[model samples]
Target: MTVDPRAALDRLIASLEAHYNAVAGRQSEDDPAVDDAYDILADAFEVYDEALGTAHGEALPFYLAEEDDDEDDEDDEWGPEGDDSYGDGADVEDLAGEARSS
Candidate 1:
């Protein structure tokens, strides 16, 4: 049977998000697969909203930084936070730079 790619994508994303939140937020149990999902979601969000150059909102004119180095302290970090808050502080740009530097 044929399937809608976007719909399938959405379902996959939802599953990942659910599992990721369950483990990361609740800390009920650690699953390696879900850990992988969390990692994948981090990049997916960036590409979907940020990389696409979409505006955050029409009313306010807010935007996501084009470069990770340009990330602000107030903005949530892109990758995993130690305490498991995905929105915690960590500069995505700085993180990217560190990755390249390595």
Candidate 2:
């Protein structure tokens, strides 16, 4: 299967976040491993963010709301290409057409 970089990044971030949360319960504030995870997460996140910047000429969101993810296909809503919607975008043409038809 072809790997969608953005989707892969999303999954990785989620996994890392969960790992951090779990380790948080088991580790004290002074633990070096806890600090290491933060460093690793930051480095991994930088790769994802850099890929987003290089691939799309924009900063992809680090996280999205659960409700928004379910509202439409992530591929449809945030496809890596031909999806021009970023900040301040709402597909006015589509919206207007839908409104008129309704």
- What TM-score would every model get versus the actual structure? 0.30, 0.43
Off by over 4 Å in 1: 1-16, 20-30, 51-102
lDDT, residue 29, candidate 2: 67
lDDT, model 1: 0.52
In model 2, how large is the Cα lDDT of residue 58? 69
Positional deviation of 67 in candidate 2, in angstroms? Answer: 34
C-alpha RMSD for every candidate: 13.4, 14.4
Q: Give model 1 RMSD, 1 decimal.
A: 13.4
Worst 10 residues of 1 by lDDT: 51-60
Candidate 2 RMSD to the correct structure:
14.4
Candidate 2's TM-score reads 0.43
Tens digits of per-residue lDDT for model 2, 47-101: 6766666776767656433444444555555433446553236565766877999
Candidate 1: residue 5 lDDT (0-100)? 44
Per-residue lDDT value at 11 in model 1:
59
